[model samples]
Target chain A: MDIKSLKNYLYWLYCQFELITCSYLMEPWEKLLFYTFNITMLVMVLYTAYIFVPVHISTAFQFFLHLLGNQHENTVSVVK
Target chain B: MANPSAVCNGHLHHHHQKQNNLLKSGIYKKNGITKGMKKNGVSNGTLHKKTITEHFEQAPMYVAVLTFLGFGVGTIFGYLRDFMRAWGLEKRNVAAEREQQKDFVPLYQDFENFYTRNLYMRIRDNWNRPICSVPGPQFDLMERVTDDYNWTFRFTGRTIKNVINMGSYNYLGFAETDVNALKTVTIELQKYGTGICSTRQEMGSLDKHVELEKLVAKFLGVEDAMVFGMGFATNSMNIPALVGKGCLILSDELNHTSLVLGARLSGATIRIFKHNNMQSLEKLLRDAIIYGQPRSRRAWRKILILVEGIYSMEGSIVRLPEIVFLKKKYKAYLYLDEAHSIGAVGATGRGVVEYFGMSPDDVDVLMGTFTKSFGAAGGYIAGKKDLVDFLRTHSHSAVYATSMCPPVAEQIIRAMKCLMGLDGTTQGLQRVRQLGKNTRYFRRRLHEMGFIIYGNDDSPVVPLLLYMPGKIGAFARRMLEKNIGVVVVGFPATPITESRARFCVSAAHTREMLDTVLNALDELGDFLHLKYSRYSKSSHPELYEETRLELED
Candidate 1:
């Protein structure tokens, strides 16, 4: 909903992929690494939701509009 | 003070005090700010849980809607990114095509455009899908099973149960997995570990390599033999050592590409004669010996006549006796490439020399490979003891490249022993006989059906002419749909107009299998209008007249 929550979600997704990749690697401590990652992800998601939701929603709307406009311009030029 | 704002300020002050303690411990940095109040002053664990529960309950519908929107928008953006990449690639390809058209020959430009836009891309896109995995006789292939008019490709899982194999080079069926030669290989692998880890001149030569070389020399009836780690390199790398700038080479016009490379690499003056034409070969040899060379008029230090025991493309066996007579008459050393003929043609599989009743000693240098007939991997140079010793020291392949692995060498030795009847069994003799019989039978059957086939009747590599360009792909696909794996060659591999499907007969195939293939081919022949019988109107007067009358109407 908000910029902070979105940022937290993206970071969580990045960490999830990292955990998956680490699991694929031939590491002895992969299970331990995944356990630590799961605990940290829960704390981050809740903390960001509690403190930063309202302020970020407004800022996130502006950033989203800017991103859409930039991509539209890029697609037009590339097509030409 | 009894003010409403006073209560809010008091709660905020308490939260700020707790935040200060947490911030001092280096937490809540990426979350921007943690200046907020919870309903109660609880422990950190309880507080964290309370925050999560409160946030979710506060706006359940809002969270769900935003979550869905995030996923939807992310997917759309990802697809747009891929689309943009593809659009850029098309533009680049178009520009490249325009530049190529301007710079290249028209035929080459046309070929480039066709491959880039059509054939090559289709091959790359469907590379893994259409081609069967573990390619061999009776391989596992994907079959389209129709269920209630809706069709889907399904893996049969059972080695294409009854599929006829006309694709592999397993001529005597020696390459089949169930051969006893593999037992020796397994034992050799355990003894020698996997590879020798060095060139033959170094420490790569094991006792197996020496034993195999001796076995090859004994089998070919030569004084000595030297084996190479690779078949292609055996010819390509060894030619330079045998011939040099002062020498001249008379090669067959239709010799294999590896032979061509070896001749070119030698830097010798190369002359190509009409394929298997004894008169053309004699003329080239006589001219080289009498006139010396065209430009320099310098006497050629030596003359080498290069020919294959069997021409792979045309499936024609070489006129070895005539060629040998010319080689003797002109004083040119003969180089016979027996890559396909070895373990295939003769009664005991001694190759074309034996097939023609000529002695192996008559040829100066015999070049053959174990890849085809021996069901192993490697090649050899069999000749006089002095020549073999010379090549061992001078040949780049022997000196620089790693020697053949022990297991492969052992397998080749076993195959040769079996062929020589040293294994005390007639299985190898039986396979050789069966292959010869199958080849003639299949070729005769094709002739009887009125389909045009190329190559000697006894040659296993038979190419049935498709002639039409579009039919190359169509014929192959149709045959595959009928569960036959066939090798088709077009354009660059063969003459542009002479596209054909090459069928190799293996000893593994039975008479019944060959009969089934003939039946399937007859149906395909009529459907594709490929049969000469269809074209021969006199033979089928009624059908021809009906077609002619229909055309007139």
Candidate 2:
């Protein structure tokens, strides 16, 4: 193939790889596993938040983080 | 370094090795591959070996995904199970709280039922009939015939106007009208509001209240006075606040309910004397003086001798001179309740003490109520300034409750002013003497008519005895038909056997009204088949002769 055609072919292959990876990540099984890991990590983070930080500072930080994390997770799940 | 075909050939060799191993093993026997194996020449087939990673990659992707999915589902279920257990514990705690609340319901219900069903029922059933139920149809027939003449109907709008109001302690016509005094009350009401919202200790104390106290003290011949919301509170607060665990109260058996309630609350040992019996009072005083000795070095203090100035039910005046002598001899403090005698008895409406010409200081404490003479409400206790000061500070009823209404205090002040010569001393004293004369005339006339009169000869309260309970309602109805108003007294308030009709003679009544009332009573006696002949001196001889002949036979 000519040099331009070869460059076009390489770009097409990159797009195909992206599509395959996205479809696999968006599957119901993959989503369920992701959510379970996310919730477990959140529980551990909350427990650590109470122990390592002063109550007032931790409470304010926890509320902001929980709101941001919940919004991101909901939007991602809905789009999928 | 390797060719494509060589690498493909190496992968095929490995796959063939794995197939050979499967065929050589138990797969051939389990599958029963005798015909298929012979056709394919299974013995000559090569087998291939695969690596662990390569074998895992060959497995379905769903199997690996399902394993992680199962672990996630199991974790969520475990959390849900723990949450359900906590919810169950909370529900049990709520149920236990509800059970604890259920225990108090029956006790509250029982108290409500007792007042509603039992006490109120008895009051409703005996509304108009004398407190004592009359036997037979005689009372009913009299009531039916005398509907128009029923004075109780006119007064209370009740048909059963049978009760002889002997139970009422209103001995004087004070509860009745003194026209000039009432007119003054209307004038005072225009100036003062109806009630005082704050307690006596607060800003509610009015000038009229202070004036009433002064008037009451002067009327009773004392140095100072303090008012109470009720006669009951007057006795309950004054008695207990003065006497302590160290003191003894010598009370009369026939003392009013307020006195009894006060003595009980005083925390003092109570020594009761026989009704109107001076000997018994002396005996109690001696016993208390001896028994009240402290085991320690403390000497016994003086005792309090409590008595009513007038016995309400018996209508007997207290033997004031004798009581005063006993009180002085024993060195005991005397407390007298002149509830019935204030506006009705004595030479100048000064009650039992004035009747005997005794000084107010002779009695340590003098308590009286305005409900009787002033024709209003409230009570007062008169004593030395120190005792009044102590009571004003220490009495719980005074400290806690709303003060007496300003208008009621104003009315009492005006009434006392009228009694104490706002008009003139001559007119006031004249009215007082007229009341005494009327009481005597009414009592003598009733006694002469063969009516068994209860109470002392000087008392304005004339109780006509009807020995038979069955005749009580009939007698009251017949008297009402004659345009005469009288009250019937019966059981619970008095002994059923002593049922009678009580007539309260007022100073407002004229001689003509008295004469008319007597004539009507004579007619009532005839209508009821009651005998007036027994009262006649001329008919007595015949009655005696008839008894003598029966004895001879």
Candidate 3:
């Protein structure tokens, strides 16, 4: 993956991790908005990866993004 | 403007700005640098939903750990506080126990030392004795008699056989172990449990209380009777309950302590007459009527005359007919305490009124106790229904104390029944008659032997005069050596020089016992160097009185 892709993926992973961890400490409005934004960004990253496009995302960024996505799914199911 | 170096530098600057925005929002703002970030146009973390979730995640784990630590520390501190308190109490208890042990002394030695130093010296020196003294003259006399007579006064674990109880107030010997009476008591105990916990006004009173009162009233020939915890309490409760602030009490000087306490508590004006002196009583009565008037207007209410049916220490009977005559003449209420008379005097052992054949109505109030002849504890006052009704409401002692245990009341009832002839009238009368005969025989025999006896000729109490106060101890010691029990009463209970040994005769005494006691007395007279011839002369000095005539102008 390219540096630009790596940086964007890293930003997305950081947001998802922050949204899940911060949810316990945040008020309900902040927690809901952050969670929705992370979910939208995570779907966009996964769709870009699945389309076989020449994505510029780096290996490290992909690894972190995958870890955040799995954690987000687990947290959402627990809340439901 | 398309310079390659400039374009690259611009791209690097834009990328740095975006990364700085993300880092400022995530790291610096979340780490609480709101003031610095807000100045740089970065929004403060106004995310309410995120903050709430954060608080929930932190509360559970933090609260659990803090609460558990607090509880553990508190338990340890609480245990340490309790241990320190218990240790302090143990130290205090040990000190108290050691002090008590160090001070302990035999009661008899203490009593003797107290009496000799305090009582005997005061009497010998002609100083007035206090009302209650330990080693008082009276106790000295008792000790002297016990020593001289070789009497065994076994205080602990007393039984019928071990005791030759000359100090007992059981005048007629009715308190003797009667098989039939014991059976009655046992039957009553089986029927009723041991005690009733409430006062008479409450559920504590039982049918036995009513029955005992009824029997006592009938025996005394009065309208009714109200029971009390003791004979002393009867006077203490009834007197104050009956008379109030404006009333006057004319008391005989020799009336029992109960009467004195009762009168004092009543807040009444008390005038004491000479012992058994009706003239003095009449004078006091006349004076009260004349002087007990209010300065504002009319006279005060009539006075009350208080006397005992029998003077216990002197063993003298009250001149009841004269007292009744004076009561009627002055229109005063007469209150009689028959503590020592009932079950001992009168034809049927009905006490002073019966002994004198006077009507019960003549005496306004009559009180007696069960301890003497009834072989039980407690007392009763017999009077008109209204007076008893008033006392039931006002008597403080009655209202405050626990009610009498049922077994004691039952015993009194059975004893009263036995005395009044539920068993048989003939048997009861026979016992009383025998007691009268025994008293007469004992008194006559002692008088014939030249002993100066105190009291009326028919009285059961025969107080032998021992004249020399100093010899009281020696005389008592000799008497005790003979295994005959008698009490010596001297100063305080009696006048200093009037010290004497008081002998009580009971119906239980066999003829052999009387003979044995008389023989011992006769032997004691010689042993103590007492001259029998001087007894007649000293006891009857009136025979030597010379008549003188006075001239009037």
Indicate which candidate wins on TM-score.
Answer: 1
lDDT of 2 by residue, A1-80 (tens): 59998886676554333222221112255346655776799999998988777977878887898777755667778878
lDDT score, candidate 1:
0.69
lDDT of 3 by residue, B1-553 (tens): 1221132231222222323333343553454433443454433444221111000011234323433443333233334433554577322211123434656753333434434432343223112211121121111222221221121222233221222445456565556455665776777778887776677776766788887877776666556778876667888877888787788899999888899999999998788999888789989888777777556334556588999987777778888878888888888999999887887777667787666545566688888888776657888888777766777778765686556666788777766665665654455555566667767677666655666566765566667766544345556545655655567776567654456777777666666676777888887765453423333434433311231111111
Put down candidate 3 lDDT per residue, A1-80, tens digits, no spaces: 69998897777565433322323223345457656876999999989778755455565667787677755677778878
Go through the candidates in order and give the C-alpha RMSD of each one to the true structure: 35.8, 50.3, 48.7
Local error of candidate 1 at A45, Å?
A: 75
lDDT of 3 at A64: 87
After superposition, candidate 3 runs with Cα above 4 Å error: A1-80, B1-163, B293-298, B529-553
Model 1, span B1-553: residue lDDT tens: 1121132232223323322433242443433222222233222322122211000012234333433443343234334433554567322233333444766654433544543343323222112334454344566555544231121235545444446678878887776566455788788899997797899999888888889988787677667899998999999999899999989999999898889999999999999999788888888888887899778899899899899987777788888867877877778899999999998886678788767545566799999999887777889999878899999999999889998989888888877777666776767777887788778778766766777677776688888876554355557767877877777775566664465788888887887777788888988886665664333434423343453364354
Residue B277 displacement (Å), model 1: 1.2
Estimate every model's Cα lDDT from 0 to 1.
Answer: 0.69, 0.59, 0.61
TM-score of chain B of each: 0.74, 0.65, 0.68
Order of models, best TM-score first? 1, 3, 2
Docking verdict class for candidate 2: incorrect
Sorting all predicted structures by lDDT, with the top scorer first, yields 1, 3, 2
Which 10 successive residues of model 2 chain B have the least lDDT summed? B48-57
